[model samples]
Target: MTDEHPHRPRLAPLPEDGWDPSARELLAPIPRDADGRLPHVFTTLVRHPGLFRHFLPFGTHLLRHGRLAGRTRELLILRTARNTRAAYEWGRHVPLARAAGVTDEEIRRVGAGPDAPGWTPADALLLRAADELHREARLSAATWSALAADHDEAQLIEITMLVGQYHMVAFFLNSAGTPLEPGFTTEALPAATGTADDDA
Candidate 1:
């Protein structure tokens, strides 16, 4: 990341020494490398401390308090990452998606898209919802009804918010040129099969 993207980030991340007491307390739980530094996105976002403070609770809710199944949330997040061409987001979520029970093959196929063979009807619809929202900014009636069958009112609301949240996250990650930290999020984000629609 250093050499390949030395100047890619338009905004420099706050160096560790510059972290204040509040910043340190806030970032205490974030993963650190052998060098024990915070994640690139966190350090970078902290450059805008006010925005970071306000965004934390909302992001935390989607990540920790959402009603969707872990695997479901991960799927939406990964799909949203692909849709936005946010490689940083995609790389970060690959392991999380896997840990949440999404298989390696399934992860690969997500890039292939919701229509790719082998997805169960439910899984396909979930990914399709991501695609429809990404491309159209809203879900189709068919997709919505299909999702409604398995998800309750709260889960349904969670579904849209979770996917939309990642879209917002992706926008910042890409625009800010957030670098993937070493020993973390090193997965290669592959381009999906078709670029007439890509983001695999």
Candidate 2:
């Protein structure tokens, strides 16, 4: 969908003086597709080569070689997208989630929060952990206990890092007014208003 607010600043390409061209070249082997190339808030970050380089390896690792199952990764990502209201992230990952076998209905229910019907207990726990992490910046004892029951230490670390990564991504996208992809938009939450039902 055309961004209602497209007049925001477009980030320029990274300069060579501050960073190794070889590293960028290494990263560029994975060129963003037409969709990925669409300038968004993320591109703006490249303006600071140092910050871009720091973030690049982790993003590359996660997208290219992370060991987590796609379903689990997408669950964490979707919860971050919804919690932070990052339209760019939601627009991109919704399709990725489907490709990983998350049904359209299940993806829709992500915005439905904890009460979303049909979520498996495991799914609820994962989403809740993401929510708790986003809101309070730490997992509650109950949430940590639920996650511990289902995930080993490595997986738990991956999940926490993934949530933190997406949280940072969403922060940039929202703060910078990143554009959503063509024909994509954030799904409306069940309550329709800006606030969730429980907020009342």
Candidate 3:
């Protein structure tokens, strides 16, 4: 992987002292680390409470309550992380992928892309869907048909939304310079073995 990120934060994560009551209130219920601090994405975004407030429910729903299976959702997320080269987003979702029963080998294959050996037909469709959406914002008919064969309408919709949402998050984290929280420890996106994985 290239590991190329020349961009710096145009607006850094809001520091603790800068958190106003509204920001504090919004961040309070969010899961926090051992230090009782939210993720960089949350703290940085709390700087804009209006957007933060609105983003919470939508993001939480996709991550927690969506119709997509956990492993399925994580595959799409990890693929988005790879396509966008969003390091922070990639780092965060990996453990979630693990918890969802995505094995170490499968995680590596996500970076290699949908065509890598061992992926089932359904799994390939998911990764290809992410790549297509990232490149063109639309799924091909074949991809759509393949996905539809297994997934209901709700799951299909969630698939598009999930990929798009992470693309947006990648934009924010990359542009805002959301740093990995201190003491965070997780393996990075698997390094690229082909053009499909320039970085993650």
Candidate 4:
């Protein structure tokens, strides 16, 4: 899909030499590209060093310590990215989603949403929960019950927070107009089929 709003970034990425000491410290744990440059998202976010410092720990927890399975978390993030039309987030996570074992077909189907054919029950429930959260800010009774059946309370809570976290990340990426990293492509997945206007 063509970008509807290709606005230039309101906060441009900081040059490497321009990074604050605090920002550099916060970014230390993130892996660098072969060129030793940080990802565009990090570079852009570090323009606000205080926010970047506080945001990284929680994000690291979600990525490294969340109770949700890797594939499940990736699915939640990918769906959230699509729901929010966050091209930068979507592009960055595509390979991570794949490494977590989301198939190419399943990735494409994510754009079609929970009702799309061929999803296992658990996968469908995940997508439905993501859709409901994105559109309505709450899960339907049935979706909540379905999720509760398979996940422990901790996992269930993590799932909800995981989606919310990615939504916040997407909002920031889209609002700040963060560009995709070098060689990144947002076209790997299909265009999102569900709109914000669609009923959850």
Candidate 5:
């Protein structure tokens, strides 16, 4: 949650003075600021238009479809963002997570992870799934069983895919050093109550 971690932009964002026509089609789906500038993440990706074009459809599907509820999806995303220490991802999703009915306190608590107080059993399961995936790259049998009890096979698959997708996203944002959008702040959230090594 801390912005104290040094972040240096390795690739400059595509200048807004004149958008790349090659990437214009891909940029169409992304929300833009009043200045018509895309988020640094998208603009950074736009530097490779082919990859951005290919990545957007799957990303859009995950955001818009799937059996996972919006709240649940955001919970997983926020936790994954925290786990990876991806400040760009965390900053970008906080608003979307809030819009999906995640409380400010809940957003703050996500950094504390699955063990934080006040999460429902289902919410806890979602966080635990994300943590397990982040730490181990796969869910333990116990976590999988708990997830399967409530989520259908499709939803379970979406959960796994969503976590993996965000992990990839975090890697890109971190490695490329994507900056937070203008006016965005990387305020510190609560720290995790326990490490990922702790028993679930």
Candidate 6:
């Protein structure tokens, strides 16, 4: 996938300077207070703690426990990751995608835009929804019909929220220099494949 983020020179080691160690501390497994423990980005967002609390539960619902089918949610997330080229979001979700039964072929195809032929009908609709969401900020009637035909009301809402949430996450990760997870690797896609930009 493309890495669209602005480049930054690596900063020197932390903990040497007197800067708070809270950032690295949160990445540890042990839990801490809400303000003390979160993803690195969340910890940085502590400046706006109220927004953190607000998005946390809503983001969790769309991502962790919402009504959307696991694989469908992953497909949407994968599309968002590529659209934004958020390396860190892609790193975190690709494993979740695999666990949700997304194969390497499916993962590579995320960059393939809406018409890639190997996807199931549901998967194609999900991709179309992603495309529409990116280009128009909402799904078109035909795309929504494709989704609503198979998904219930709750699932439809969940999918909308999931798309919005992941868009936010991808923006943050890409803009804030959220590093790709340690030892994370993405599968390579075939060259000259159809892409979201081309479809757009």
Residues 1-200 of candidate 1: C-alpha lDDT, one tens digit per residue: 11132337877677889889878777776777577777787888877778888888888888888888899999898888777777878887898899999999998888778878999999988888898888777888998899999999999888888888898888788778787876655677755453214522
For candidate 4, the clash count comes to: 0
Worst 10 residues of 3 by lDDT: 191-200
List candidate 3 segments past 4 Å from native.
1-8, 192-200
Model 3, position 74, has a per-residue lDDT of: 96
Q: After superposition, how far is residue 76 of candidate 5 from its true place, in Å?
A: 0.1
Q: 61 in model 2: Cα distance from truth in Å?
A: 1.7
Candidate 2 per-residue lDDT over residues 33-125, each given as its tens digit:
465552444445665557766787898788657877889899889877877767778878888898888888888888777657799998888
What TM-score fits each model?
A: 0.89, 0.79, 0.91, 0.92, 0.90, 0.78
TM-score of 4: 0.92
What is the C-alpha local distance difference test score of each model? 0.79, 0.70, 0.85, 0.83, 0.83, 0.69
lDDT of 6: 0.69
Candidate 6 residue 164 Cα shift, in angstroms, is: 1.0
Question: Model 6, range 98-179, lDDT digits (tens) per residue?
Answer: 9999998888888886798788877888888887887779888998888788888988887787888888877766666755
Task: List residue ranges in candidate 2 displaced over 4 A.
Answer: 1-27, 34-42, 183-200
Q: Which residue pairs show backbone clashes in model 4?
A: none
Q: How many residue pairs clash in each candidate?
A: 2, 2, 0, 0, 0, 0
Query: Which candidate wins on lDDT?
Result: 3
> What's the TM for model 2?
0.79
Instruction: Report the lDDT tens digits of candidate 4 across residue range 1-200.
Output: 34564578876777788766787787788998777788888888887777888888899999888899999999998888888888888888888889999998898888888877899999988988888888888888998898999899999888889899999988788778887767676455455466444534
